[model samples]
Target: MDARPLLPSNEPDVASSPLAVRGLTVSYGEKPALFSVDATFPPAAMSAIVGPNGAGKSTLLKAALGIVPRLSGTVTVFGEPLARARSRIAYVPQRASVDWDFPARVMDVVLMGLYGELGFLGRVKAQHRARATDALDRVGMADFADRQIGQLSGGQQQRVFLARALVQDAALTLLDEPFAGVDAATERAIVAVLKTLKADEKAVVAVHHDLSTVPDTFDHVLLVNVRRMAEGPVATAFTAEALQATYGGRLAVAQLDRVAPR
Candidate 1:
């Protein structure tokens, strides 16, 4: 994990950012993948970056993390630019994007979370190893620590990757389809952790495709489609017109569920 002190200096100008994104844009060679988009994620809310395929949900998240080269605009985590503050952040890539075929064990994969800060090619220290194990236990992957990643079930793999991110213990996390291809139980577990992150005052942005769970899983929403069409409190922004614009009216009756009033 990043042992760095909480850099309160950059904490999102909560009043200004939530997740202030401006002039944001992206492209794939000659083709434009995203347009001049702008958005903000309200603080202390579970936000879902949602849209149909090709809506640029993934691209938006990637741009926020600097994983993709943005053509223009700025992405600020808290108040700090993501490029200048990676250690303060954590990312969980899409499961399908990983090499499940690789020869690493569950523990090894989680340990990579430390490789970013660990000495070049040096062995992982005891504390880092312990952190990995603790992360596994947190995600309920403790028993599978020694097992090959490919030998585990789809749910197990997802937890393992999350454990890796958990080890980072970042104040902000961005997950790309973390619930994809997982079972109900796994989905529940991941959602529970997401709640924990929010309870801990961390900001989380999840790229979600299943509109069914959007209501229950998020308090805020960012509707995308090669451009940011709308973003705000879930109840207000997750409207039918926004969905139509983002999905090109191609989405079936949106199966979005509603959160029970507190």
Candidate 2:
């Protein structure tokens, strides 16, 4: 694994982190969702965002992408604001967030990824379609290209979303719960795709809940519970202490031992 250093709070080094959040605060009306959260995610590695439910794991990703409003702080992608770096980023939101009843076909959905570079009115051209087809093939969903998105299974739908992200060819990919509702086979396939992304030196950050697989699935982790409890290489940052802090004794000791093992 090509381990990268986490950036210090005072230093705003662009090259060190693919995604950087500093003093980030978010709220839903008066109630705070996240507070003073800070962390750096690097390239050439897969990082998992782990915490209890409602830990603002999804909010952190959204704020970084500007999909959600931030109460304060900044999110930098490859050293610049999100507007300037939009084309270089790809995001897969949680599966449950989508309207499965939408009338779009699989091909139509995957083609959406190109909208950043193609603009709203730009023609999608034959080559772009071919690229989308190739991406679908990579995710094992090529046969479903013409099928309605609502007709597919949960795992299949997840693959189509991944295919969309793959077609973007982005340097940084943020995924919220890729494994949610996915079968073992789909999970393995997704991990394989993530490995390919890391091999290409892309940064892949995912919100993951399955603690047992974290050690094998990612090289780094961001343990958060409203505020970031820990962030770094999995071996060092994913400790019993961090887990206890982030989970607040809700986690079983056996699980912690398996995850951190002293």
* lDDT of candidate 1 at residue 80, scale 0 to 100: 77
Q: What are the per-residue Cα lDDT tens digits for candidate 1 across 1-262? A: 1211211122234344546778888999988888887777766668899878887888888887888899999887777777666787788999888889999999889998886688569788899889999999888889888999999998999999999999988877889999999999999999998899899888888999887688778988887777776676776677766666667766555332232111
Candidate 1 has what TM-score? 0.88
Candidate 1 regions exceeding 4 Å error are 1-18, 253-262
What C-alpha RMSD separates each model from the true structure? 7.3, 4.0
User: lDDT winner among the candidates?
Assistant: 2
Give lDDT tens digits, candidate 2, residues 200-248: 9999999999989999899989988887787878877877777877888
Runs with alpha carbons beyond 4 Å of true place in candidate 2: 1-14
Native-vs-model 2 lDDT? 0.89
Q: Model 1 — which ten-residue stretch has the worst lDDT?
A: 1-10
Return the TM-score for each candidate structure: 0.88, 0.94
lDDT of each: 0.79, 0.89
Candidate 1, residue 170: Cα displacement in angstroms equals: 0.2
